[model samples]
Target: MSELVVAEGVALELRPARLGSRAAALVLDLILMAVLYEICYQLLRALAGSGASDDTVSALDIVSILLVAVGYPLVCETISSGRSVGKLAAGLRVVRLDGGPERFRHAMVRAMALLFADIGLPITLITGLPVLILLGLPGAVAVACSRQGRRLGDLLAGTIVVRERSETSPGTMPMPPHPELARWATTARVEDVPPGLILAARQLLSRVFELDRTAAAELTEELARQVAEHVSPQPPRGVAPYQYLVAVTAERYRREIGVNDPSNGTYRAYRGPRPGFPGTRTGARSAS
Candidate 1:
């Protein structure tokens, strides 16, 4: 349940694949690869035909064998957008650390590094301390301890294996209220803002307080535009873009949490900023 913040400021909680699931996927892939290698070996032997010249064995047959051993997962994962038969079965997928789809290069790096660590099949047979040591040593050890849950290959490839989840599952900041924005926050229907925009809003809200004053204004404006695309009715005239964003966020929070707005006691829970703390209200300066 750890979240990753991408460059665009979208926060997503990517469920890293467990070591057990990763091992299972590796085993399943190995079995398939071994079966494939056996079939290829048989075919090559037949073509080399017991007495065939060394030239054919050295050239075409060796190349074909190598291709089968390395090509299967590489091609499958790259073409399938980071999914293999084994990964599909294990409910896992390889994705960039930035939370984008894995590209061919990402797949290739992981595949090649895995070829070294796994030696194609060794990761399954070579269990116990060695495998963990292999992955948990160096850059991987500390990173693994972090939220990412990356292995050596994942580190080298700048990728990680994660179980996909709906974007809204890992919630963001609770509904912080604003007196000026509360009216709109209570009535807005943001349940349909789509996961991507919701993530953007959450990220903006969470990070806005940390940004430089002018930069924060620009950032919030851009984020507000993104959120407004999916939200309806728009903010009333003179509402600052940031206020619009907070209202939408609170509305989404209410929908997901089933909380009643204390005033009227319904699901529309938009109230003032914290009791004594002086925030919001006067900060909104945006015009229509």
Candidate 2:
């Protein structure tokens, strides 16, 4: 698992794609490329037979090869945020070393390295013949040698392939420290909170235990303070900041799913607060 520190010092654990999965995705992509190339070749032939100029036919042929063989990965990755058809099928994604989305330049460099050095498609196009030589071996070797399973293109582009899907479902609901806090949360107005802040708080809470105790406490306090600014009936006194944050998050989740309006009978998995908090107190007493 690779640990990536995102905004607000929240660290996320991402698993790198395995070699076998990467190879399978690559093979699938190569097969699709072959099919596309064949279609383009046929179209070009049809144009040539229709009395098209030799210069036009030859230029079109080069363009076809470059577009179908060399441009496939570049366009797909750039548009889909580092997911090609094969990668999407295989549940793999290309992300930067810091777990950010890959940019167009990263995709371009990777595609050039892949076609010229790894698969040798550009060389085959230039020679006007298929190269039976080591196609895909160089990239495979680079991935095998690298500890993080980085191929040549990935190394050049500052990207790494990671598994996007998890084996188990995640529980995203946050629970307040005390049951009575739920009552306060249900009545408290929370319509003014920014969506980004809520998302950040959720991420921070999910990985709270993995962080250092002191750092986690500080971050939670800071985030909770920010959340309080947008909430009404300011969090009750004698309660830790995280408890208030949890109550707000849980209330938001409940409202989002219409749990308050209807009896859906849907079960939710709520994560309780982390250890080390003091014992729970009585009713939601307002802060002075």
Candidate 3:
């Protein structure tokens, strides 16, 4: 399973396509291309037979071959957002290494290299030296050696083809920004929280806001326990777990922003000595 960490720090699990499925998909696409090529080939011949000039026929043939052989795959993948008929049928899709959808340029680059492997290699083999072996052989070897089955084209394009996987809905908002926590947040330091746990906290906070009252309270408590494992200096006895997470996560956001430019004034920097957080005797900032 391939896991990608998105902007929200949520790790999304994706399934990478294996060799067998890739090969089958390629075969299906090739068959479709062959049918297109044959239709074009026969039409060009029929035109020549119908008293069209030999030069006209020859030119049209070259154009047809180029369009059917090279142009089809390029157009299909780009227009379909990294899916050809074969890829769609095979439940595969192409995406950037960063897990974003591939764009037109990426599709074009991948297709240009694929042209050498799909057409040039076979044509070259018909000759003695197999000149296009440079393209096809290297790409095949790269695919075999790559952990994610990337080929030369995919590497050059900074893309990967993965089996179609379920998508996750991004969180609506993160716990409503906990404005009350901002004062103490300036002094609070979050320790021992894993990134995944942090994401979970964010997700739960967002979801709980939309849940029924009983469900929200129940989920909040359960999620807080999961979050608490990674946090240090637990909240005081009377404080609700959900509220504790709000303060902790809010502090984390402040610190992350403050490191870049403390003068940015994104956080409310209370005057005087730093107040100890919940359960500590240090003078706490008064709520405005």
- Candidate with top lDDT is 2
Clashes found in each candidate (C-alpha, N, C closer than 3 A): 1, 0, 0
TM-score, per-candidate, Cα-based: 0.52, 0.60, 0.50
Clashes of 1: 1
Best by TM-score: 2
In candidate 2, what are the lDDT values of residues 1-288, reduced to their tens digit?
655554456765566787899989999998999899879978877867877787887788777878886689999999887889999899888877644567799999899888777775666667776566667777888888887788989989988888766411133676433566677776788655544345556677676767777677667777777677778887667667667777777777777656542133233643455554332232332221
* Model 3 weakest 10-residue run by lDDT: 279-288
Candidate 1 structure quality by residue, lDDT tens digits, 144-255: 4656667667878888777644445546544555654666666666775644456556766666666666666766677676667666666677677676776787777766
Instruction: Choose 1 or 3, whichever is better by TM-score.
Output: 1
- The better candidate by lDDT, 1 or 2, is 2
* Better model by lDDT: candidate 1 vs candidate 3: 1
TM-score, cand. 3 vs. native: 0.50
Better of 2 and 3 by TM-score: 2
**Model 3: lDDT of residue 10:** 38
Over 4 Å off in model 2, which ranges?
5-11, 48-60, 120-130, 167-204, 207-271, 274-288
